[model samples]
Target: MVEHQRRPGWAEVEDFLSATLVQGGTEMAAVIESIDAAGMPRIEVAPTAGKLLMLLVRIQGARRVLEIGTLAGFSTIWLARGMPDGGHVTTCEYLPEHAAVARRNLDVAGVGSMVDIRVGAALDTLPTLLGGEPYDFVFIDADKSNNVNYLKWALKLTRPGSVIVMDNVIWEGTILDPDADPDAGAIRAALEFMGASPLLDATAIQTAGSKGWDGFAIAVVRQGSATLGE
Candidate 1:
């Protein structure tokens, strides 16, 4: 079953935090600078989303985490911070410059050892990762055009009960309309896949704020061999 909830914009909260907490943190400031230097879009997760991901990781006792996008390592820092003592996160970023910035940010965060930033197209990198092991949490935030493909690959690499969280699922409300463009269509297809998959119990929550009109789709893999949509 699929469920959803809409909340006040998250940007306001993020703005407030940016002004108060993150404003004077040298390391965080440096990370932001690195992101800016990379020229890649530095779209970090909303504060609430970051906290929620951390909580989910801890709750699931996740030892292995997979992230499809590492845009200057903001989300990577959050994920790494949530891991258990020996837990690790493997994140993929296609842009070399962006990956370098992310590496620097992660290093400054003091969680560098806990994160592995792989530089390559996620489509090519994900398959190679499959042979290594299963992940307890998979965060997808890469190219929207390949969301469906990513979901398929994620499903195969995650064990039952693993959580898969897709960022930008709403695509600024474009997916809500019948006249969605190509990117929105790709997101819609991913949503349909999640809604129809019997192997997952999923929900979509709409959020607003500094991040604009976007949202996340979270799917928890069900136990046993049941298919999705069953």
Candidate 2:
């Protein structure tokens, strides 16, 4: 993993943007506190990024969302809030303890009913989601080592025009050198898959903030992409 260096200016600008634009409010604050209280990792997306997820879901007109990670349900809350009434989200968490924490946070956020927290390795859980409705949006943010696996599953679970968002792509610029670390290598492989796949039109953006230098990649499944169980 790259050593995340937090320059003062990056954090300051992030705070300013989050306040002036994100405006996540007290509810969002409570969710953040819950993560701390549960001693969970504070690796949830920034407020601005959360808002971006919301906007992306809304823009996609997505009624079904598949999330490969549920870190205290922080990003899950954003995804849930973006959907129209009766929309649902299925999120996978690898740890039962984490899932419990996330359940509470989602309930407190008033979006619990819309979220299904499945506790298991995402690769194991993703296959179970098959034979269901095609997800309109997919978010992959769990273990970096399985990013390419998650991306493949996203393709199977979604239809053409569906959007997929993968977080922590930049990894403090380790992506440029695939040999930098295990995560760097895996992330680079995933990016290569995205770029070379005929099924996706994708791009990655680098960002710096309180989380330090990192980024996310967004892709839209192209028309006629092969979907499993089609």
Candidate 3:
């Protein structure tokens, strides 16, 4: 395993960007507070990243969003807020306790009604959504080991032109050496799957922030693409 380096300025700039453009406001703050209160891992996306998710949802004109993680409902709030009046977000969380905290946070954020919190492994929960309307956007931010599995599910649950975003792809540059860790190996496999899949056009970007050096991959289902695992 390689040591990850962080410059003091990265987080400073992130805070500045959050205050200037992200402006998450009180609801986001309360979500963060709730996570702390529940002793949950503070692994929610950065404010800028959360805002980006919101913008992506809006830009995609997504009425239905599927999220593989619901940590304190921080990102879930952003995803829900981006949708139109009747938009819905379905999020899966493995831990019941984490889901409980997220439930309170989502309700407090005033977007609880727009969100469906599925408490279980995402692989199991995702299967239940198979026959529903296809999601317009999908966000995968859960356990790294199942990234490709989540991507496979995303392909199954989304239509052509639907967008999918996977977080923590860079993983402090550990992806350059998949043998570094189990998570790194899985991330590498997921990226490889995305790159080689004929049904998608995808790209990834590296980012530096309070979360250290990490990044995300974004992909769009190809027009006339055949749905996988049909």
Candidate 4:
């Protein structure tokens, strides 16, 4: 059953908006279907959220993007579409199966050439990324436990003015409750880290939509960004 089944009315509105406003959303629908058919978890970002990322890309005139999670590449496609003609997106995925599906999906959507998929435990992969000519935009949607670390790396790999967006920050409005979900611990920790950390000027935006009650956190690297208490 589609997640929209839980909130049919709002979901319908989102669907309508996608049909009318989201360019390339038709192909995005097919990408979701393909991901589902491959038996991957149905946890990709909502269509509206995907479009929002693309909007940010356009707003920033971002030429280089880094994505922490590449679930079937749905969001990757959207981010890739938002890039300038020579722009590129580098996304990391832990699961090889999911990476394969994402690759095919990107190809079908005709943006494969613009994306480079790095498959492995992100912890092992993130540290190896270069800091020279830092990325302009980054999206983190991988395991919540490592979000803090990912944010650390994001700060290291990006220069001032770069944008980093983290999904599921609200944990379905349970961010305040320590035991609300398994990820709550990490979510809470990451939020706290961002709050006092000098590296990012961040805020969490709660949202309820076809994907249910959740939200994303967006942070911009300030001048002289650093990790933790550095």
Q: What is the lDDT of residue 83 in candidate 3?
A: 100
Q: Global lDDT of each model?
A: 0.83, 0.93, 0.95, 0.87
lDDT value, candidate 1, whole model: 0.83
Clashes of each: 13, 0, 0, 0
Q: For residues 92-119, what per-residue lDDT tens digits would candidate 2 score against the true structure? A: 9999999998998889889999999989
Give the range of the ten consecutive residues with the poorest summed lDDT in model 1: 221-230
Model 4: runs farther than 4 Å from truth?
Answer: 1-8, 224-230
User: Can you rank all candidates by lDDT, best first?
Assistant: 3, 2, 4, 1
Q: How should the candidates be ordered by TM-score, best one leading?
A: 3, 2, 4, 1
Tens digits of lDDT, candidate 3, 1-230: 98888755989999999999999989999988888888888999999999999999999999999999987889999999999999999999999999999998888889999999999989888999998999999999999999999999999999999999999999999998999799999999999999999989999999998999999999999999888985
lDDT of 4 by residue, 1-230 (tens): 64654546767887787777875645788887887799888999988899999999999889999999998999999999999899999999999999999998899888999999999998888777764568999999999989889888888888888998999988766777878677988998999988988778999898777887889999998976553332
lDDT of 1 at 162: 92
Task: Give the lowest summed-lDDT range of ten residues in model 4.
Answer: 221-230
| Per-prediction TM-score to the true structure, in the order listed | 0.87, 0.94, 0.96, 0.91
Clash pairs (backbone) in predicted model 4: none
